[model samples]
Target: MTAKLTDAPVRVMIVDDHEVVRRGIVTVIDASPSLSVVGEASTVDEALRRLPAVRPEVLIVDLQLPDGTGIDVMRRARELEPLQKMLVLTSFDDDSALRESRAVGASGMLLKSSRSRDIVVAIERVAEGLTVWPARAPEEDDELSATDQRIVELIGDGCTNKEIADELGIAEKTVKNRITAILHALGLQRRTQVAAREAARRRAGWK
Candidate 1:
């Protein structure tokens, strides 16, 4: 495939299954001076077929497609161009989807409800090699149960599973389960990372 001309506007591809949504995104990109919609596809197969000919600088893909999920498209697209950027457009807020998208090399997630300006900004950010997750308000940070927060706090304090269980007056196994869920929710691998993140949040006075 021919590489993008250095002087050309940032080329973007839209892969949402909905025609209206695809048009809406195209309009948004068109209005941005630095970005342009170079191609559009409604299914994973279509996206894969067209991607070789139209290798966009960034791909805005919806998670659910008629042929397969956007994750499938992302994996294939990455194989075609390892450096290609991916931005996920989805209505679902499920953590599993977020984790899977990130795992398959998506750089950002934009809700369908996001304003046009935010969508445009996301496209730019992804093109710039930045990872984009939604911003959460202090109140929104309260998604974790109070118990979960306390558990994370104890982790920050370097508590063991037995220590946390005893402190929270719960079974040790319960503490382990809660910690597992917290890691999944935070998309972290280790307890130390979770603890460090929670500590940073506390220091920053975020909720």
Candidate 2:
């Protein structure tokens, strides 16, 4: 947290309820030449219990957990180890959660859907007192707004343009144009491809 100066691999911890997700991220972190996984916890209580002993330099945390929440872990860690840095790794892009994270001393946030390289870079920057997560506050319009994500989910569920408009209480023409833009942005030629891709993301709990 104090601008890591040592060449030793930065000590990192991971906290996520899902075993698959925790292990997947551990693999990515351990693979990084400049990082190392020093500890892991699946619940807020567990994280607090281990913090004093493990003493990680940075913590890669998920927003939701079986017990309390990542905010609990971050807040408690701030008390126990003021120098420990926190990096949020979550599936939800909710603005409220982002605000809460920054208030609790999280240095940066990353989506679980981020590329391996991006995750690695985020941890590295946060460890050095640099920042990322658009490297600042959530923009009014990110690459994908919450409304656009809802539309993608509806498409994945096989909703027709008219049905999507009805569900979202918007005009059908607007739905059509949004679909066109989403497909173009994703570099897909057909709506079916969007359906297939987004469907997979939803299945993996990327809401």
Candidate 3:
């Protein structure tokens, strides 16, 4: 479902190199009473040049642009409007893209294959100052090593380090080290958050 409409619609800009994708996003945003597309750009240079004038409250940017990476645009956008909400809409789902997008101050990230309703909802959440991301990639778990992935699965199973080590036939110290590495890789501060995230992913039908 799309977000509830407020008194003033959130102004948004669409920046994608593909015309079809940009138009599709525009259609989605325009259908929502709470969101409005104020501008569109097919390249980083164009987005940067028009950003000041358009001054959208939220920016839906594709990570790949004709002239430069979306990170470049994000850096420039921050310089122009430090508080402006930016949501990354992209086809790339690599960890580097995900991590870099957040590191450069994106409020959210959504894959291109996400449902239109999900996209709209994510934009609304981002416009309202919430961070948005998928529970997990629907495909392979490429970011984590197989051992680390098993550890995440074990954490989800409510296993303690010693129990997990025993189950996996590894030392408890190695288990602790792998757990710490998993937390760092996912940018999470606690084991509980990692467990929660994995649970969410499982609920979302991730194998």
Candidate 4:
């Protein structure tokens, strides 16, 4: 997902379970000239309802929520807009949590302990289709081709074959065939399983 191609401030939505957490982020965003807070949500349910309405250029989300995890929100949000830019701003730095965020199409992950300036920069970066996550390359790929790697990213972003076709400017049949081959190459039975590891050998980093 990419940010709006304009000079206007980035429209951002903050989703956190705690008001104080949200407020702290809000304060940081408010201080950045290139960012603006458009909406806020305290739970997955509320986030689902408000996210589409706000249609933010950047989404700052927490991993744990009252009703569901931020991965649930990002997954649902990606369904509505596969190009939606998202960043997981969480307190946890474990691999399972980080990989989960990557599995749902997050462009970046930032620890809550990071500096205020880092938060502002992460929002801007994700909005532009650039990653802000700590880099930890996967040990190795299962000999996935370049094209196969791209398909994995789209699948993780909740894109259908048709959608992937449109994004890659290929036929729907081609997309389907490639996905099958990709699954075989990765030794994975389901698309969801392979989505956790992605293109460019970009493994989830714990930092």
Instruction: State which candidate has the highest TM-score.
Output: 4
Lowest lDDT 10-mer window, candidate 1? 134-143
Q: Model 1: per-residue lDDT, tens digit, 29-118?
A: 899898988999999999999999998999989999998899999999999988889999999677788779879988778889889987
Which ranges in model 4 have alpha carbons more than 4 Å from their true place? 1-3, 137-207
Please give the distance, in angstroms, between residue 80's alpha carbon in candidate 4 and its true position after superposition: 1.1
Superposed model 2: Cα runs more than 4 Å off: 135-207
Question: Lowest lDDT 10-mer window, candidate 2?
Answer: 133-142
In model 1, the runs with Cα more than 4 Å from the true position are 1-7, 136-207
* Residue 117 C-alpha lDDT in model 1: 86
lDDT by residue (55-114, candidate 3, tens digit) is 898888899887898899888998988887898988867778878988989977878887
Local distance difference test scores for all models:
0.83, 0.81, 0.82, 0.79
lDDT of 4 by residue, 46-75 (tens): 999998799988888899998988999999
lDDT for residue 192 in candidate 4, whole number 0-100 = 72
Q: 162 in model 2: Cα distance from truth in Å?
A: 56
TM-score for candidate 2:
0.64
